[model samples]
Target: RDNADNTYTESGTRKRMGRKGIGKLAALSVAERVKVISVRDGDKSGCILSLNISNKNADGKYEIPAIPDDQINFLKIDETKSGSAIIMENSRYSINKTIDSAKRNISLIFPFACQTFKIHLENLTTGATATIDDTTMDIVKLSDALLTFSDEDSEYNEYLNALHGAFDNGRYYRVLQEKLPPDQLPAQKVLHKALTTIKEKMLLVTITGEQKAFDLSICGWIATFASSSDKKRNTDFPVNHISIIANDKLGQFDILPDISTDRMGEAYVVGQFFVDLLEETELPDIAASNRQGYKEDDPRFEKTLELIRKNALRPILELKADATKEKNYIRDLEKANKAKESKEAFDRSIREVVEHPDFKKVIHDSQPVKQALETAWELKDTLKDTYKKIMISHSSDDKPVIDELERVLHFCGFEKEEILYSSSNYYESGFEAYTDIYDYLKNFFVNTTRKTDLCVIYILNQGFVEKWDPVLEAGAGWVLNSTWYPMYTDTFSSVRRPFPGTAYTPKLNFDMDEKQSRTLAGAIYRISQHAGKLEQTEETIFQFIKTTRLYHG
Candidate 1:
């Protein structure tokens, strides 16, 4: 009876769960009274110790009375020679619920207890009973399964081979390893080695750190199901938690907050951190009275947290980030490759159409042909907008007029990026001295892959005819069989004429009032609409030339 009563009466030093000597008070808080019965070898019958915690003295403290052996209640006992039983009576909490909570708490906190002893619970009302054992818990089962295989066994060997295969296959893991510091590789290798040897479907990662001043070695293993699929295989312990183990027993059942910010990683990870240095007698008691967590400022506790963040959590997060980037890169590469293939197929189709004898016959007759031609022009535009669709071929002296024309084109909704013009200095200095101006222009037009549809607007003036570069540029346009529009300045009386067949090319006057600017802009817009399809009406061409004559006269 004395031993049974003393179970909750005495305080003790640190045990496997830490220095939490007040755990017995939990029973007192839930129930009004506690009854302990014992059967010793010397006693003929069992003696019972009863304590009524609800009845307190004037000072709000319970006055427990001392009962002599003769005055103690005696009960018959047939189960064991020396045993004790605790029966909490008139309980404020439900018996079934308390038993359920006790089972879970025992499994988590004292996982090793079932290895050496047996624990059983019975429901008095329903006559149902449950046995709590090591096999009932996931962590205990996983730990046992891991120890089942020897390192030399085929099962272990197969696991190591598969692990290496997986490591080699994972693109992100390779990237992560390459990015980590050289010194950190050894530790990562150790973790990989430890993981491959594990027999169960769990990835066991070991993280270790040394703090010399406190004589602390933060060492632990984070065991998570090898993948999310592995976790879904079991549902008994569905709640995700990372148990904090000091020595071999659990201190805090959930240390997820210190480990991961990502919910997916948190849900799959279940681990135990061993910080035996925290249990040293000289160190201050940092473990909470419930044994669920540690005090915020505990040095050993703080060191363990630091080690976990730096050695384990940080690496995992970085690997995930790298994996995400690699995945995005692959997706983008796939998109670009598809676009390239589509462009190649499109360019081939355009080449077939332009080379066909009936292509020009269908250009104005069929809408589909015109649309295909426009698509071909736009596809070529992707290479270099400068030379593909529209280019202003002019001398440096024609800058003011050409700039105004460019501004008017832009005002008429033409993208400025699509227009190309080179200054006299750019033509001389930008190109190789040996490179002919005509050769440079031909390369520019051909590089765009749209020489057939390229439209060149020539600014004709005294400077334009005198300059060899401008004359060569115009001849290059003719050599490519491109559409050319000659715009001469009103001040220039004499102009170098184009060849007989090219004399019918549309001509515009450079000197422009607001009305002439609008007229020029409208005519350019009308020509551009048909230039892409290589089609222009005689009436539109005549109107453009007539407008130029009206403005010049």
Candidate 2:
């Protein structure tokens, strides 16, 4: 069960055909009549191995037959980008079996791929994940728990860091209270420290066995709500969602004393508090150490409002006439201050592009100048440095042109590696193909393990009318912008589709110079230089495509 291998192997023990762990060892023997209808992608790469078994075969040894070429399935190939997607299939998996395994093989295997589970379990029989009832399930406690957790897993380590930050924040929010608990400060700090280490875009999470075990109720909800949807049932199992839906579900949030556009970031910070809380539910004992973390200030601030409820404010204000206008003005001033602070924080977070002195020579007066400066200062922290990257923009129909361009880049000193093409080697259609492309691209965007420094797009007159090309080009431009700003008109929304009867839709620019690789490479190079990241050689960026794809240098 290596992290890199998405497949499962017999680990602890092996057993006879009728016993427990046998299925994990290898495919079982099956009748000669076993058919091989299956799912595959159009790609000639990224293949996975699958085995099938039946109860009838008398010999224990696998008398396996090769899957025919006709039985093999392929994923859709995107003509516009390099990525992967989720592959769906129609099959006769019994209720006891998963799509990927038979009913009897579940504990050793599963319905979907083994990669979906955090740790091996008897889920094959249980229908629900086993739940544990430790206090570590509390977000605050888990933040505390992370102190003992080292960075063995970068993703989990980051989760621990965010928890430290959350506790720190709890203390800061306590300042407004009159009798704030003394422990509130450190509890908040602990969580805050844990939060700072998370990568920005990761969405999926898996809990190992020793990690927090949720309640059967929670597990049911996670399976139905978080896991794959049930197409035939048109619904998944449900659980008690009421507890998870409370207004102060995690904790309190405060308006930053005033309302200002600048304070918007504060509001965001306030809202994100909930996310960090839920993420750390794995470690419960930390709460025992954090005795003062969940303390609250007295609620006596309601006393000031009691006067108004009792109709005393009008009379008091009348008696103190001069203070009325002053109080009103002060309230307005507070709002203005909050807005300023919010914007300042937001700017600080999104602005981190590196702008060495050389950037001015490329993108003079770029708006992300402050970001560039910060990037320059943090130059030592970058993963790689000074690698050349070339971006290609072209049409799919001009595959030959791209290939020639790539050949030229190779000749010009670009390696056959490090290139990211968005135009030629992607899925055009098919379930398996779609999944393959989606996975690759999503990981590139969300995981720390995979990211592209340069972007290339192919534009053809006929290709411009389709949706994928412009969608990818916008994505590339966005990456170069370094600010990760979403486009309204220019970008194709992944969440929403184009509406029917709409009066307008964006038309992609259909024309481009066929041999402009050098110019395009220069622009991409500029982006790499600004980020102070490893630069890809223009030749390397172009060569891989030359071997098979149409887009070249």
| CA lDDT of every candidate | 0.50, 0.31
lDDT per residue as tens, model 2, 226-291: 111211221121111111111112221221221112211111111111122222332221111222
Worst 10 residues of 2 by lDDT: 217-226
Tens-digit lDDT track of model 1 for 1-553? 0122332323543233435456446556766656555657745233222344455689998756443555434443454466655666677755435556557655555543444456676666666666675422354223211111114433224433333333322433354466555554322221122331122121211123322244454444443343455555423344445555565456666766764543344455554445555554334556776656777566556666666655655444334333334434445446647856876797799788786877677577888878887875664554432323567777877675555565444333244434656642233214445756565575576564444545677777666767887788787776766777766654334345563223333344554454544455455766466444223333333333332323342
TM-score of candidate 1 against the unseen true structure: 0.41
Worst 10 residues of 1 by lDDT: 141-150
TM-score of model number 2: 0.18
Q: For each candidate, what TM-score against the reference?
A: 0.41, 0.18
lDDT of 1: 0.50
RMSD of each: 22.0, 30.3
The clash number for model 1 is 0
Candidate 2 overall Cα lDDT vs. reference?
Answer: 0.31
Those runs of model 1 whose alpha carbons end farther than 4 Å from true positions after fitting are 1-20, 37-83, 89-114, 117-121, 127-129, 135-214, 225-238, 247-249, 259-264, 289-291, 316-553
Collision count for each candidate, in order:
0, 97
Off by over 4 Å in 2: 1-394, 422-435, 448-462, 469-473, 476-553
